[model samples]
Target: MSLEIRKIVRFEEETLIEGYKAAETPLRMFAVAAVVKNPWAGKYVEDLRPIVREYGPQLGELLTAKISELAGGAENIEAFGKAAVVGLDGEVEHASALIHTLHFGNHYREAVQAKSFLSFTNTRGPANAPISIPMMDKNDGGRRSHYLTLQFNINDAPCADEIVVVLGGASGGRPHHRIGDRYQELKELGHDIENPAAV
Candidate 1:
């Protein structure tokens, strides 16, 4: 079955000043959301995999394209994440099903040529619920600077039988990132950097 998308929402923001200091360049953040009709609303499906298989890749392609465009290009996106909100009539697992699959995430990961996993959030809520997409460095999760979140809400989304799926990205880190990355802390604490399992 094809995805029945009601609307596609796009959000972008730029920060030029932080901590009373100008950033070397504007730090930009972007997100694209698709409001879709939940196929199994009001019914408990024994297996959610079928829908996940059918719709996940489609959403991955659609949102990745939109988010990449918003960030200028996939190559320009330094950080990335995703989120989903299932309507009150649906289960939280429905929200999770749409996004927590390789069929969905692989598209974004491949588009950006990323090594690290994409960050994500999923929940069940009513219209205009707060949607927070936590992000991390596309290639280096240990990088503290690229740790960020893109939060936005659709005033009339997930209307009891709908779901809002989203993808978010950033051109770079915060305007003034002073905190060093986690890897640095590991070294300072004398952790065995060579064997990752020890840490």
Candidate 2:
């Protein structure tokens, strides 16, 4: 069981304009993706756990390092996310198996010291299909300003038996976050932030 990586793709953006307001410095967001052969493409395997587990750390280390480098560094990161796209011949589960695992996602979370879970997407598609990676504040899921989604497409990937795995990072939160923080919402509602279910 091995991931025959075909290629690695990276997309980056630095925004100076958010609607009308200008950011003092551009807000940076980036994603790094890998196109690899799906080991269980056409089989209905009752057990995907072992294969999932085996690939997790290998991809986690590779992708986390690439994304961190693209975003500047792990310390510069303020938000994070991940996503995957499986080729038409593969099941959606094949896409999900690579990303929806602690073995894979934990590497990025730990690298950025993010307490929040990595937001994700998984689907089956052809080459050049749109892929989106949803993100949140590394340390606080409730931080609305840090909630972001990075999107990109690979022109030639997931060719019926491959999967595209992605990792995303942001250098800063929304440039013009006027809605207020999660703590403010908790305070206004007289709700304790510690126990959110009570709210």
Candidate 3:
């Protein structure tokens, strides 16, 4: 079997809440999620939930590292806050597993003597997990792309100034076409392919 991994699509945004303030010290929240491609899920595999559960901790580690880098360092994560994991399409159950693994990121705060506070949206009734942000792409030729967005909010905390956010997506080779070279070749051949959907 041939395996290829690519980030077919990605989006990131950060903002400094200038005037925002928390009522208590060491107050903040963090959230992270990944959209992974499970090649062997729901097909040859008898049970994927267990596998996803096992992988959740690993994914959490990756997200924590990314957030630590984004936050400048683990020392700066004093006011740890609410954290969550959300999965996109074909990943509902995986989201629950990811949430279980999210706590692995809190270990970083141990060295700083800071409390790591976080919560995961449950998979049952009122506690059902929250879906990450929805991503959509459409073209005139019936070509479409989709993605999932993860979101986190820091609430009422002062010890931490900002929360580092990270997102990971899984992509197979299906949507990995290169447009730059194709566009150039098309132009050279007197074909207009300009204004391709700016994803």
Candidate 4:
């Protein structure tokens, strides 16, 4: 089924420092959000699996494309994530139904050639509530530099029967990163470094 989108929003941010320190190049984060009518709002259904299964891929493709566009392009996006907020009348499960499945997430993951699973949030809120989209490196989920969050809200959106779905991307990891990457941690811990878990 097609996504019954009420509105779409995009957010972008660039950072060049960690506190007072400066980085040679800036790190950028981008998010694309959609406010849509929640089909199962204000009612309890014993089965939510089918509804999510049918709609997940469509929303995944649509939002992933939007985020990729906002972040420059799929090829340029080094980190990625997703999120959803169900309005007051909707169950938190409604929000999760839209984003938690591979049907939705794999589209974003494959589009950016990311090996890491998309970081995500699912919750219930009122209009204008904060939506945080946490991100991680596309190739390496545990990369400290790529762990980030893009926060935003739609002032009048996600009304009683609505849900806000978001997809996020980043051009690069945190600028001036000093902690190190996950591969290094694995090596230091004497763990198998060749096959890492998907983040």
What are the TM-scores, per candidate, against the unseen true structure?
0.96, 0.95, 0.39, 0.90
| Cα error of candidate 2 at position 13, Å | 0.7
The local lDDT score (0 to 100) that residue 167 gets in candidate 4 is 92
Q: Which stretches of candidate 4 lie over 4 Å from their true place?
A: 186-199
Q: Which residue pairs clash within candidate 4? A: none
The pairs that clash in candidate 1 are: none
Best model number under TM-score: 1
- Report the poorest 10 consecutive residues by lDDT, candidate 2: 190-199
RMSD, every candidate, angstroms: 1.1, 1.3, 19.5, 2.8
Q: 3 or 4, which is superior by lDDT?
A: 4
Candidate 1 has a TM-score of: 0.96
1-199 per-residue lDDT for model 2 (tens digits): 6668999999998899998989976899999999999998877888889988999999999999998888768999998899999999899999999999999999998999888888889989999999998989998888898888988899898799899999998988888888888888888898888985686
TM-score of 2: 0.95
* Alpha-carbon deviation at 13 in model 4, angstroms: 1.0
Each model's lDDT comes to: 0.92, 0.90, 0.35, 0.86
1-199 in candidate 1: lDDT tens per residue?
6789999999998988988999998999999999999998999999989889999999999999989888878999999999999999999988999999999999999999999998999999999999999999999988999999989999999899999999999999988798988877788877876664575
Error of 2 at 168 (Å): 0.3
- Candidate 2 ranges beyond 4 A from true positions: none
Model 3 lDDT per residue over 76-163, tens place: 4433322333222223343344444434534433432333233234221111233233222111121222222344322221011111
CA error at residue 5 for candidate 3, angstroms? 6.1
